[model samples]
Target chain A: MVLKDILSIIFISLGAFFMFIGSLGLIRLPDFYSRAHATGKVDTLAIILVIFGLVIYEGFSVNSAKLIIIITFVALTNPTATNALARAAYRFRLRPWFKKDKSKKIKKKMNWEIEIVLFICLLIAAFVSLYVKNLLTAVITLSVFSFFTALIYIAMGAIDVGFTEAVVGAGVTGVLLIITIYRTSRRSSD
Target chain B: MHMFFIYVSVILSVIIFIPLYRVVTGPTIYDRVLCSGSIATSSMVLILMVGVIFNRIDMFIDIAMAYSCLNFIGVIVFAKYLGTLGSRRKNGT
Candidate 1:
């Protein structure tokens, strides 16, 4: 019993350490692709480790079986989601950030310029979406705004609300807006 | 042992801010998507740890599993929808 307890502690702590490292990489990495690589692979492994430790602590039981099922589900879905996101981004023409480019200086300047514009636009879009004449643009801006709000909810430890926000607010709403735009006129009169 | 779980949960919660920063400042929409995915995963683990702290693993495990499924579906939908936007634009229809 003591041996099992010790092993579980070791595994859980190791998992936490990896989780920290993965989040660190997510922040410190320079580009979208690298950040995806960090979160997609490392975070999956970390969750699996932590769950395995919990399973060991629980010993043989129905709950342990459930934990195993959760592990399998996460392992399967995480990579698929990551792949889909990357493919979509690639299709959308978002270039990967490379470290050693010949035109590094020019790229750096452009990066700052675009970052500032996007930051300002993100703030403006929130308020502007409320009063925008065009419904489609308003929907797009609202989705962007909701994405940030979802992150805030998660950080606040409201995981259930965050999950709902991510799915309904960002996912379903975006799809519904697209369908609406397809059906109605693209432009709106104020 | 319960105290250990509580401490670990607190540590995990603090670790979440790292990815939150990325989500807020990510260069592209995809980066934000990735960071949010990471945050979701962390929350799942944190939920499980909370279950441990409260000695209610049975209930929380189900919630965690459902949350994971929802997160996966959300990401897949976003990707599929966004991926086709480019092709549709080029086809001009």
Candidate 2:
């Protein structure tokens, strides 16, 4: 029992570490494609590790069985989602930012100071999405907002609400908005 | 075990903001999508951890499963729609 507990702790911590690294990479990476690479591959592995740790902690039970099912679901869907998003972006003609792209304009660099700062940044993104001139960027920003909201819900112990947000908010809403942009215009005035 | 789950959850919640930073400041639409996708994936793990903390793993597992399916379908639909749009633009229809 002690050994099992120790193993679970080790695995869970490792998972959390990788998850942090993945998110860090999301912020530090240079381009869209590179950011996708960071989030998609690393986050997938982190989730698997975390879930696997939980399965071990629970031992062999109906709950662990369910967790295994979730593992399968996540493992299958994550890459597919990443692939789809990448393909969609490519199809939309959104160019990946490259180091030597001379046409790229300079923008203000983001500094990581505090967690509250991150939350404030999220609020800013939400407002920017509302006011951005590009409809596609607006939709993408909304998707980001939805995802963060889902995380907040989960942290508050509202797992069901978070799940709903994850599915409907981040998932369905993003796709619907993209479809709207496709049928209409990619740019917005003000 | 429960305590460990809580600590991990807190860590994950804190880390969520890093991706949010990307979403906010990302230069392109794809960067936002990718960042959000990362956030979604992490949320899935956090959901299961919450399940462990509350001692209700059974219910949350179902939610996680359904969430994954929805996420997958959403991405595929968006990609397919955009791909069709690109082709339509090319065909001049």
Candidate 3:
């Protein structure tokens, strides 16, 4: 294969791998705080890598410089935003999830079951989006579908969009939602 | 190379949906504010991306800059409201 093809494949694969890890973090982390940690740090890092791949593919173009600038801003802001959310949560007195010992096996088991169901549902939603319905439906289910479509843009050399997706999807959305959950209910004290 | 631009734009818009979920399901006013900020941040990125996708980064850069300023103002407004609410509740006590 040509060098461009080789690079594209490698970068895409790397991005996918990072995304997978980030998703796993979403599922496996015990609670909102840890989930924020996983989503914000690992996901942000993965997307930066994906954008870097796109930047390389777009080399020497003006778009490439813009891509780099977006990347820099994201790298700077993503973590700060997440930190701000976490601080907000802490200031509001949200508690981290901590399971009691096996002496409370029944309650522990219940929590585990709840977590498993959440994971399964999220997974199913992700899987189904791969072959779902019409464009309108797809638009509705868009977030559930993979970011693989983004690779197409990179292959086409649209670095700016790739950077935007990484920041908005992984960075801001995750932090805002986590903080919102804390701010919204009695659960903020927990 | 052109296809690259398409992919980037698609991805940028695609991810903007995630925050919309928070905006829709928000349990409180502050949540909505936070989600709106996320949306604004994403839109700013989208504006910049649009410029790049269309090969007009200069124009989009201006838009993104303006949007960022607006977003900052919005966040500050919300935060100020939050502060006042907290102080009012305290004063009543």
Clashing pairs in 1: none
Q: What's the number of clashes in each of the models?
A: 0, 0, 11
> Tens digits of per-residue lDDT for model 3 on A92-163?
445667895322111111222212322333354355444643321222233322222322233244645644
State every prediction's TM-score relative to the real structure.
0.74, 0.81, 0.48
Residue A143's lDDT in candidate 2: 72
Rank ordering of all candidates by DockQ, starting from the highest: 2, 1, 3
Report residue A45 deviation for candidate 3 (angstroms): 2.1
Provide the lDDT at A132 for model 1. Answer: 53
- Model 1: CAPRI class: acceptable
List fnat per candidate, in order: 0.55, 0.74, 0.01
* Model 3 segments more than 4 A misplaced: A1-32, A61-63, A98-190, B4-8, B26-49, B61-93
Question: Which ranges of candidate 2 are over 4 A from the true structure?
Answer: A91-125, A158-168, A185-190, B88-93
Worst 10 residues of 2 chain B by lDDT: B70-79
- Docking quality tier of model 3: incorrect
Summarize candidate 2's per-residue lDDT along A125-176 as a digit string, tens digits: 6897898776767777777677667656665678778778877887778887
- Chain A only, candidate 2, TM-score: 0.72
lDDT of each: 0.72, 0.72, 0.48
Q: Which stretches in model 1 have alpha-carbon errors above 4 Å?
A: A100-190
Q: Candidate 2 at A48: error in angstroms?
A: 0.9
